[model samples]
Target: MNMNMNMNRKQGQILSERFEVAFNQVHDALRDIVQINDDRFVVLVKVGAKKYQIIETYKKDLEQYARLRNAIVHEKMEIGFYIAEPNAKVVSHIEKIANVFSRPNYALSIATKNVVYFDYRDSILKVTAAIKEHGYSKFPIYKNKKCVGLLTSSSIVKWMAQNMENSSVNLSDSHVSDIMTYEKEHPIEIVAKDINIFEVENIFEKAHRKKQKIEGVIITEHGRADESPLGMITAWDLIQIDYTVD
Candidate 1:
């Protein structure tokens, strides 16, 4: 009840208009996302919140906005009167959320840039040197300019254990391919440059449900092994991202 008897109706009307537009934007985004058209706005929020981290993040605020929208649209008020006018701050907040729901943050934004990689013919000594210099334990291994597989520190350790002699492994003679033998599992997924973070989050969740672990995500121009990588993302990166807040 923002009943300001002396409040400027012109200003309140403008704010109300903005609030309604933002409200509809959120509703439409949720409806399209959840593929539900017959339900109410609150119901859309309820369903969308379950599938989308962005929706879950602002579920409470959206529910409250649904109530306010009902009052603003249905509640009778005199000309230029506002019985349920949202403040500028609330309007701005909703607008920001609407924008986020409509166009999500890109996965490439959170990926590790300047992806340090390796060729199949490269020596293991070179891999060790690069790891020491960049501290990047996981690398995208390539063959003929196309990604063949992912090479992680864990796989490297396994390779070393199997080939060790007198507690020392020979890195000087082995090629990156030697380590790739230990990395038989393709634990990484390739994503397109325009892929959204929320969808990437779902991919990880789906893998977890199947009792599979995804080592990392490689971002490329076309989400294919043949395409050059743009960046990389790991579980650690996902942990650092609070989609609810970020």
Candidate 2:
């Protein structure tokens, strides 16, 4: 029984050391991402609070772990003996956090690569056919080689409802420009390609809190409207992502 207790204690000490290493790695990863050169705690508070939802969700817990790490490292130890050992739960939590930083899902990695878009002058018939044949509900409407607006199935439905009164109305006769209305309420957000999934999730969360709808995130090289979009991310795309942290 005494030997077993010693073994458990030794294992706890080893795990505590591992937790410290992982905690530092997570901090370093954040520092690199946020370009912070100050204290790790400051980076944690700023980036965890503002930038990433995953880190924000675990912020308090991570802060507590950081304090614990400091205590463990700074505590006086007897010869070849640990003064304190980290709990298994804390170690596990820190490990999960480390993994989150290490294996991040970037926007470019998950976004739909081959985007199907329509020009503003294109016939509505083409848009309808694309929707029906390709199962795509959203399309970026372009003008002068720049994405000016988004055409969604909901907008099309609304347009159809307003135009159904005209007995002579036909999709072939209507242009995308005619049906497309600038939706000031739900504007498409542009984000850089390097943005992580956690940041993207935070964007949606913030929009929800403000009662604003984000139609989609248009990923570009520098997140500029003038730059050609590299990929696209919708709320549905985020919903389909399995964020089950291991």
Candidate 3:
């Protein structure tokens, strides 16, 4: 019985040490991302509450763990054992959080690449065929070699509703510009290839609060619309990775 108690104590102490290490790593990662000149706890709170989507989800839990870490480090040791040793659960949580920050998933990593787009003059029939063939709901519309707007499934549906006659719309006669009018309300956001997935998720959240639904995020070389889009990220893309941790 005594031996078991000693072993448990040792395990707890190890976990406590590991938790501290993980906490420091998280702090450093947030510091780099947020560029805050404050204490570790302040930085953690700021990043947890506003910076990253994954971290923001666990903001309260992280703050609680931060307090526990402070207690573990500041409290006096009792007979070579930490007075407050972090349990396995806390240790695991901290490790997972640190791992996410250490090697974060970027927007470009998950975005759909080699995108198929349409020119402003392209026939609506061609666009419809591409949509049917590829199961793509959103398409970037270009004009003079620059992206002018996005043609989405919603815009197409709205257009069809407005123009349909006896369940038939003139697809060949209609042009991409005809549908562009419907897309004016659903604007596309652009982000750099290096933007983290968490930031991308936050962008969607902010847009939602503003009641402005962003159609999609165009991933460009330097986040400039003039640059060719390397990839695309939608709300669905963020949903796939929101709660998943590597």
Model 3, span 144-207: residue lDDT tens: 8788778888888999999999988878789999998887656788888889876787688778
Best-matching candidate per lDDT: 1
- Tell me, by TM-score, which candidate is best: 1
Backbone clash tally (model 1): 0
User: What shift in Å separates residue 183 of candidate 3 from its native position after superposition?
Assistant: 2.8
lDDT of each: 0.84, 0.76, 0.80
Model 2 agreement with the true structure over 41-104: per-residue lDDT tens digits: 6555566556555566666777787778777878748643556677777788788878877777
User: Which 10 consecutive positions of candidate 2 have the poorest summed lDDT?
Assistant: 178-187
**Candidate 1 whole-model C-alpha lDDT, 0 to 1:** 0.84
Give the per-residue lDDT digits (tens) of candidate 1, residues 138-223.
88989998887788888899998999899887788899988888886867889899998777877776788798988889999989
lDDT of candidate 3 at residue 63, scale 0 to 100: 83
- Candidate 3 or 1, higher lDDT: 1
Q: What TM-score does each of the candidates earn?
A: 0.81, 0.67, 0.75
Model 1: per-residue Cα lDDT at residue 166: 98
Q: Which pairs clash inside model 2?
A: none
